[model samples]
Target: MTATPVLVLLDHAADGTLRPPVRELLTLARELAGDAGVQGVWAGDEDVAAAVPALAAQGVTTVHRLATDTDVHLSAVLADGLEAALAASGAALVLLVSSFENKEAAARLAVRTGAGVVTDVDGLEVQAGRVVAHKTVLAGTWTTRCAVSAPTAVVTVKANSVVAQDAAAPSSPQVVDLPVEVRASSTRVRLVERTELAGSGRPDLGSAHVVVVGGRGTEGDFSAVEELADVLGGAVGATRVATDEGWIGHDAQIGQTGVTVSPRLYVGAGVSGAVHHRGGMQASGTIVAVNSDPDAPIFEIADFGVVGDLFAVLPQAAAELRRLQG
Candidate 1:
């Protein structure tokens, strides 16, 4: 019996290097493919050859590369090339990282291939020649198992669900040039301007294993919280009230109205733990709360609770961590 190949839709940086999420996707793909082989396809305007080393290190043996214009929207064209590769490779399953761009592209590919699409897949396994996906739904209230019975299944996996491991021995992946046809719709949307966010030298909130978050109790001073996060090598997040008061950037807000996170460890300082905020981070592996109020709402869900001023607790915690590291 011949095993069908598993296809990976690659995402690369402007420098043509594979992004961390893409690396994580390839790692999961390798596991799901089992005895089956793994192949990849990337279509963009960057230097495709630059991504070869990282792909090879991740055990992707064959790659389909296509070059397109950077200024024009290439999702439509990318989907076309990807579907063609899927047909050519006889792939039964396609894996994509659940990013905004990939989500849109996966939807387009699903329509073209007539394949059942599943998004927010955090885990996957193959049983009896079927793919089972694990998804977090209903604002982290439920864990749902889904299976795509279609001949070809398209799945979008969330970032940071799995740790990426490098292949013991790297292979020089065979690169193939793919035929690209830029339809009128593909070029209709054009990028007019580009703005880059300043780097914070911390992992992305969506993927960080540890997160240190602040709330109204922060009193508009996040210095201690930021230092603690830096010491832990994690990202800093804030509650909606903290952002509303202009203490932290809205991008760092974590609540029903902001971004959702499910890190391995969540540290809440001076947080009252409103249901809205808990909705975003309640799925974390372990939660710790530091608040002055003994009856704070956050203490109800916290695995560990400390009743003390955050300004006093955070600095001491940071100092202790630094001493231990030293």
Candidate 2:
């Protein structure tokens, strides 16, 4: 009997590249069921020809390509692809990186395919010859193990939450073209005007080597934090309270309920370091805390820490960094 396929829904960036999470997803699938084959599904405007080996680096054996129409919202389109692919692939599992868009598509796919949908999955293991997926819930304070008894299951994982295992490089990835079909009634919202958030000037949060984050304590003066981030060539993040107070937009929040990040280094300033705050950041390679209180919980997770006011510490750090560069 042939082994069932474990397919990853690979999201293509504007640059026609596969993001890191898809690689991680392949790693997870390989570990969860070793004999099973790993594969990728993508819909993009640019050709995905160059991205095959990048997937092979993580154990992908095949790539399924569908032409993308930039005018349509991807989530709605993704649901259509997911329904068709899963129907034909003899797949036991369909994996997605648990972004907001992925979650939206997963919900629609689950209803359409009658498959169980699990979100925020961080680990996968086989127990009793069945896959058990691990997920964090309730602001990362609780853990749960979920198993799908159906013929198919859809699991969406938090970014960087799962550890990626290395796979022996496969032979050249097999690329197969797919003819995507869409129904008019299936489409809900039409794409109109799209706008990019301009001039935050921060580095890309997903792959940044360094990160600096502020919180409610920033009190609308993020200039110092921004300066420090600039010197370090890092990205800027904020707490939920910071975004709520209007100092930063909703995009900067990092926590269980927001974006998860795992940078090489992370710096937290004036953040109280709630569990929700730690949920998104505990995976960082190194951490530093800048707070006036010695007992702040963030200090507990820090590789280096200073008990000083961020208003004073940030500017001083930025100034010294700038001066040294000059």
Candidate 3:
């Protein structure tokens, strides 16, 4: 008996290049999909042609391109396209990169299709013919495993949950255009104007494999934190205090009320590891903390703790890393 295929929501950059997290999702999908094979759902306006080769290399046998000219930026509209793709592909499971926007899309899709939805999942597996998703809850204090008993399941997965690997045997995937009928209600809230933030050379804070965070101890100076993050080819984040003080953009804030990250490595510089901030990143695979205060709470959870001034320690660390690379 052929297993039902697994579908991945393909996210891409403006240039139509597939995002790194999408590749990770595809790799995980390949593992979950045995004989059923892996498929992609492309809902963006960018030309799907540019992403086909990369998708094919990731073991995707089929691409369900949404055949619609309407804007899919809205959650409801994107859900419509996803529903069409799900119907055409007969995929029992759909995986998406976890983000605020994608969580809205997942919820909308679940409401439209009666599918079970799980968000911020760090791990997924097929157990006893059921899709089991593993995630943290209650401010990362509790870990839980949930089984999707519904006929169809939609899961939003955290980045870096799996390492992306090319298929042992690649296949030239066939692109199938699926028609979408946009509901008028979906367009009720039209986007007026969009302002793009200036690009930082570093990776996105939410999905980066490595993240460097600064807190109140930075004293409104993030130079050391940024330098280390840049040296490590990672993203820079800030505690709420840093943002509230206008030391950094609110977008960089990482806390219970801000972005939740589950990167492979987390480096907190001058951060006190407040409950709100720790709730955001406690799930990281490896955590390192640097602070002048030996009694800082962050030391409690850090795999490696250095009781030193961040300004003094971070630059030395960056210099050493650069020298070693040289």
Candidate 4:
């Protein structure tokens, strides 16, 4: 029996460079597709030529470049393009990087095509010809394995969940352009202006493999936290209290009301582990907490906990890491 082709939504930057998560998705797709092969869905207006080499290296056999008249930023517009790509590629399974926009696009695609949709999935596998998605629930307290009953499934996978590897034998993938008819409803809301955020010269908080976070215990000083993050080459995040106090930009806040992160390693300095804050990062692979208060709530869930002043602990830890790396 031949495996069905799997399609991965290629998330790229404005300059046509593929994002880090797309490689992971392509690796997973290659495993699932087997001999049936893997295809890619490119929705952005960027030139697809620049991404061909990377996609081919990941064993993608073909790339479906969705050409749409409307802005693909709109979730509805992206869904319309995805529907066309599914038909073009004849792929029953689609993999996407989990994000607010991608989740919205996945939901809309599910409604339109009767495809089962799963978001923030950490793992996936085929069981008895069915795609089973594994995700955490109840604020990362419980793990659930859900099988998609529908013929088509759209899954948004979390970053750092799988290690991305290139195929042993690369393929020269052919790019096929498919024109999509934009729905009038999707064009109802026009995007007025798009502003790009200034680069922080650090990994993105939502998908970084390692993250260092600060809380109220930092006492409005993130120098220690920043130095540690830089040493580890990780993103810097802040608790709501720290952000509300104007210690860091709100974009760096991580919680239920802010950005959710599921990094491989999470380091919390002076974080008390509020329910809202824990809800965002509890799914991380390894949790390390450092706080002066011995009774801090974060210590309860931390895989490793230290009872010390963050100001004193962080610098020492960073220095030790630097020495070890050298």
Task: State every prediction's TM-score relative to the real structure.
Answer: 0.89, 0.80, 0.96, 0.97
Clashing pairs in 2: none
Ranking of all predicted structures according to TM-score, beginning with the best and ending with the worst: 4, 3, 1, 2
Counting clashing residue pairs in each candidate, in order, gives 0, 0, 0, 0
Residue 56 alpha-carbon offset, candidate 3, angstroms: 1.4
Candidate 3 structure quality by residue, lDDT tens digits, 93-120: 9999998888999999998888999998
- Which regions of candidate 4 fall more than 4 Å away from where they truly are? none
* lDDT (Cα, tens digit) per residue for candidate 4, span 61-158: 99988887788888999999999998988899999999889999999999999999999999999999899999997788999999999999999998
Q: Which one wins on lDDT?
A: 4
- lDDT winner, 2 or 3: 3
In candidate 3, stretches whose alpha carbon ends up further than 4 angstroms from where it belongs are none
Give the deviation of candidate 3 from the true structure as CA RMSD.
1.5
RMSD of each: 2.5, 3.9, 1.5, 1.3
For model 1 the TM-score comes to 0.89
> How well is each residue in 168-189 modelled by candidate 2, as lDDT tens digits?
7564678876666875655667
Residue pairs in clash, model 3? none
Q: What is the C-alpha RMSD, rounded to one decimal, of candidate 4?
A: 1.3
lDDT of 3 at 225: 95
Instruction: Tell how far residue 185 is off in model 1, in angstroms.
Output: 2.8
Ranked by TM-score, the better of candidates 1 and 3 is: 3
lDDT (C-alpha) at residue 199 in model 3: 61
CA shift at 77, candidate 2, in angstroms?
2.4
